[model samples]
Target: MIVVTTPTGDIGHQLVEKLLESGASVRVIVRDPSRLSDSIRNRVEIVSGSHADANVVNQAFEGADAVFWLVPADSKADSVTAAYVDFSKPAAQALKACGVKRVVSVSALGRTTPLANQAGYVTASLAMDDLIAATGVNFRALTMPSFMDNTLMQAAVIKAQGTFFSPIDGDLKLPSCATRDIAAVATRLLLDESWTGQEEVAVLGPENISFNDMADIMSDVLGRPIRFQQIPLDAYKARFLQFGYSEAMAHGMTDMADAKNRGLDLGVERSADNTTPTSFRQWCETTLRPAILD
Candidate 1:
């Protein structure tokens, strides 16, 4: 059995569907089973609880062969470490106790970069990877840059004002990916049992494109002029705080943005093996266009 966590999330839900399509026996740890569609709930073995709970994970991991692990973002987390590493502590223990054979986890890029230690959430995520790796399970950490679907967060604003905002330099080109590609890669890894040992799989997308370039694609795809606005890093943190995020979590986000701006994600060179298929234009057309127009 392959156990999946956060099965209702953007990437997790897609991964679940792909796994089911591949005829994998699936089990999911979810907070609310009702959040799952009737079709999905009927299809998979449901362990209804937070995967972070030791008892829940122990029960979910029992007789499981592999696991898809993702720590849901906690804007109200007291600290970055507590949010990622601490939240994962229970599952790490459960993995050993249950003798799960493999794990595929969602993580951020920047592990090899000099700025990794100062990159806030990225730093914590790398630490979480280490904690899991120490358990000696075959593991793959899907390290990624920003997700293109993140743009949908500003869909309403883009529809009304024709603008989106970020702290990263608009012209500083960097690799970004579609969540569907991430889910596809995760599904492939989870289904294959031959690969062993721990490694970071960098899902760098098809190409590196900047925010300004993305704005151009959005303009063309949505049939309206859209603009990229680089907001102040402090203001970015302030925006998070305004949204009710804890101070530590807000600073963690700000630091992550600052580190990305300073080339944290530039540590890896793109290659065919690590690069995924989706491009900014394709994502803008298929994903962002509908979010803005419809």
Candidate 2:
């Protein structure tokens, strides 16, 4: 049986669907099994608990042939980096102890970049990837650029204000991939079991596209003109603070945006053979428009 972590998330949900379609007996690690739909909860064997506990993860890893791993973005913690790695260490240890063979992890792009240590989420993600590798499991660390689905976070803003705001430079064609596409690739790799060892799989869309280009696409998808607003770092930090982020977490976003603006977030490492198809326009037209328009 394949064990999936964070199965309720967008990509995780799709991965679970694909695994079920493949007729695999699926096991899932979830904090609360009752929160899942009865359809999912009934079909899959649920090990209800967080991965933070050694015993919890060890039980979840039992008889799990392969595993899907992801560190959810937790900004509420006092030290976000420590919280992620501390939770990850036990899972890694459990996989080693249990002899779980293959692991597919969800991680951010630009992990090896110099400023990643100061870039908040990227830094923590890089550290998590390293910790997972230490287990000597045949691991695939799926490093993807900014997600196309992130636009959904701006759907309300685009509707109400007719604009999307960010500190990223408008001119830089930062790469992006849909979460579904990423999940599809991970599912394929997990099911096939062809590739092995600790490796970084960089996923990029057909081509790089800028934030302004994205806004233009949003205009067509939304059936109205939508502007791209570059909010100042101070203003962005203030906005994040208003959303209840700790000062450190709010400023962490600011630091990441500054790195993205400087093009440091664009780590151009990619794999050619496993290329999955989906352009930003296709993602917007097919996946995004339906959700926003609905």
TM-score each candidate: 0.99, 0.94
Worst 10 residues of 1 by lDDT: 285-294
Weakest 10 consecutive residues of candidate 2 by summed lDDT: 267-276
lDDT of 1 at 16: 94
Residue ranges of candidate 2 with Cα displaced over 4 Å: 269-271
Error of 2 at 60 (Å): 0.7
TM-score, candidate number 2: 0.94
* Winning candidate number (TM-score): 1
Q: What is the C-alpha RMSD of each candidate to the true structure, in Å?
A: 0.6, 1.7
Model 2 lDDT at residue 12: 87
lDDT of 2 by residue, 1-294 (tens): 898998898888889889988888899888888777777888998888887778888998998889999876666666657657776988989999999989999987776677777776667778888898888899998887788888888888877788898888787888888888898888987886677778888778667889999989888877989899888999988998998888777877788778777766566654575355888888888877787777
Best by lDDT: 1
